[model samples]
Target: MPSITVRNVPDEVHRALKVLAAQHGRSAEAEIRDILENAVKPKGRKKLGSLLAEIGRRAKLTDEDLKTIEQVRDKTPAKPMTFE
Candidate 1:
């Protein structure tokens, strides 16, 4: 196994990572390894996080807003969109 050293990480970011690592029952290094793996790897066609990020990046909506939109979408009547 190879090793990589990361330096100059801000204390705030490090503290957040420590909290998240504790919450997820993982070591800080393990949490960082996961972050790096997901950050570096592309999913299906594009990177996984980027796809979700872009959906929100394009739409200026919050979780509650998205939930409301989804509820409305689910309640709306669907008409046949095909043109004869």
Candidate 2:
């Protein structure tokens, strides 16, 4: 786990955070963590795997189609980049 130091927050913001924390039955630090988490990683965000699955569904792809693709697909590993 990592911690951060947020410096020079306004007094009003600090007070509001404390009040909000009290209302939510948590410490202000926990409230801040929740706020930060939500800001960075929100609930309604679309993930890549889900979006790709949705696209496959829209395209009416089936297991047989996937198997066909896999049968014809290249199996070689990509070479790593090199600098001389």
lDDT of 1 by residue, 1-84 (tens): 899998999999999999999999999999999999989887866777989889896887688998887887866578879887
Candidate 1: pairs in clash:
none
Model 1 spans with C-alpha error above 4 angstroms? 45-84
Name the lDDT value of residue 45 in candidate 1.
68
* Candidate 1, residue 84: how far the Cα is off, in Å: 69
Q: How close to the true structure is residue 25 of candidate 1, measured as C-alpha lDDT? A: 100
Worst 10 contiguous positions by lDDT, candidate 1: 69-78
Residue pairs with clashing backbones, model 2: none
> Number of backbone collisions per candidate, in order?
0, 0
All candidates: TM-score: 0.50, 0.67
Relative to the true structure, how large is the alpha-carbon lDDT of every model? 0.89, 0.97
Candidate 1, residue 62: lDDT: 88
